[model samples]
Target: MKRIMRALRRCLAVTAVLAAAFSLPATDAFASPTAPASPTPVVGGKRAAQGEFPFMVRLSMGCGGALYTQQIVLTAAHCVDGSGANTSITATGGVVDLQSSSAIKVKSTKVLQAPGYNGKGKDWALIKLAKPINQPTLKIATTTAYNSGTFTIAGWGATREGGGQQRYLNKATVPFVNDADCKKAYGDDLVPGDEICAGYLDQGGVDTCQGDSGGPMFRMDDAGAWIQVGIVSWGNGCAEPGYPGVYSEVSTFAAAIAQAASNL
Candidate 1:
């Protein structure tokens, strides 16, 4: 019984660390929200039609991203945290289903995390492709305030906690939650400048899940073009009550993103 208990304790400790490091699984920690499940996909999202989100990309490392440019992709820092230029990470996009032959696959040649990313916050990252992809890129949110509107997040992540990765992309519409309400839900875990929270406050049916990390939380602009406002970061659980999904606020790093892309 002692050996069994020890093993269980160790497993729990590891789980807690992983939850803090990325969007994998949930734990009871105050700031350490769950990370997406390994090889799993989004939760409580509906099937997305092809060409609906042309900028969506699936990271080979079980995360999601948006095509920012011909060669630049935007995702969460945790998704490529310790990875480098030769990490064998592939960016697959331009298709709704993973099995489709129309999907464009590109190898990531470089990975750059935002400065001061400490695993807990500032979760955005930029990936450089080996070659340029010709598909339309998603615009970053600048003048718009994504703080209080219905936004769409799509990924090939788990549909439920501890589930497998989705074969096709899944999308969910989540309402923005104010900072005070979000802080009430996450307490010290909420980083106001770096993170934004969104989901149902009363019920718990819609959110991003495992393998959804680094995906885009976007909205249509006045001209009807999709603008990425957030990058899936972490949360307490998959659409759990009171705990909305947290994302890296794109507006907070808009200038940084432009500078980084320009330098590269």
Candidate 2:
């Protein structure tokens, strides 16, 4: 779910410059979209049955992200401009299929951009829908919890670069490299405090790409409840070595989100 909203690469030439100073094996070299033996989620890996949060609405106007609470539709700020009737967004979750949809139409949308978010990145938005949507509430991680290596992020975005609708929600897991490893590997490409990078260094396959922005980076705890520790923001083309995908720190913004939730 990479976003070009706030930090449209069009203007940030130097941004992609430093990160490209590295590379990882391409998809074909590593795993096919559906190579079963591959760890984490191989592309074409079995998509999670789409109805968990049947109420979970995926924002799809100019931006795309999953909706959690009915009143609180979480998304990246790049999704809205607060203008235009053509800004049509669809909310569908019963089953993942982007071929064509009569997804629940959002009569109106309000974008509450996250404060102090990355100015040149896709770290914004926690929309408040026009009405309360009846959906199961997903758990938000309360602690700064994450394990080093082998974690996953799930979403309904393009499985491959410029590919078609991966209508079914999909998951991709890669080794989660620590901050030091991330910095040592990505240098300026990963700005600490603003971005946290993760993925396998050796096998560049399995990762979150362009369509995954604003999706949840899940961490399963001892109890089995999935806690969202980060939000899919951006990355340098899926699973690039030294430079994995970047996530918005959930702990950093949890309190603000809690406050926002109270309003809902």
Candidate 3:
């Protein structure tokens, strides 16, 4: 596989504070008992209620994210890769210090970001939780290509034009993108073993925004088990035509993630 392509404009676009710029051209004032408090800029990153591996962070603005799971808090290689002397980033738990905490404990003692993963492309990372993934099942895929068509990506990041929400998960849909369009959108930029291509060309609806990095791009089976197929790494403008969003194909890095998990 042509693993390396164009690197994500080096996370500049992904981490850019553009979400605050997202605004509707025209709209009517909505009504509410009290003025809607501006969306709180996610300080330690946002997340759903709570899950074993559910975690994410921004590498810009405040320029940091809180890791949730000690076992696996995925991240962009650029933000927390071998670049750091510590094999992977250190999280203190909670929304901030995801590395260590007596109250909020999640540990794997091992952090693994792809060795070759840089800001270039395919920036993927994995944290081997402290304990075994004894949950029911969240199967890992080893196939390099995405046979699955549709998938959903959720994050607690800023919307089209803003950020700062402490909670409340945000999401978008993604359709598989072919190599041709991938190159057109980002030529010689996709890094191998780092990034995989994905986005909607027809539906015109799904895309990843800020604060979405390190989150799962999951495929839903009839059984309803959300199988992680990709990781939200980066993308072009909020939503662009022809150019769909790109992700780090999870299967391609399954071995690394699995190996890291085994240590726990």
* Number of the top TM-score candidate: 1
For model 3, residues 1-264, the per-residue Cα lDDT tens digits are 232222332132343333432221211111121424333222122234434334433332212232323345555554443532243223333332222132244333455567765456546665544453332334545775444587766654544423332234444556677666677777776554555677766544456655556656767655765577776666665455666667777777777766654553
Give the deviation of candidate 1 from the true structure as CA RMSD: 8.6
Per-residue lDDT for 81 in model 3?
Answer: 36
lDDT of each: 0.75, 0.53, 0.48
How good is model 2 by TM-score? Answer: 0.72
Judged by TM-score relative to the true structure, which candidate is superior, 1 or 3? 1
Best lDDT goes to which candidate?
Answer: 1
lDDT of 2 by residue, 204-244 (tens): 66666544566677667779756666666766665555556
Q: Estimate each model's TM-score.
A: 0.83, 0.72, 0.62
Model 1 residue 54 lDDT?
85
lDDT of 1 at 215: 86
Off by over 4 Å in 2: 1-45, 52-56, 82-88, 98-105, 118-122, 147-149
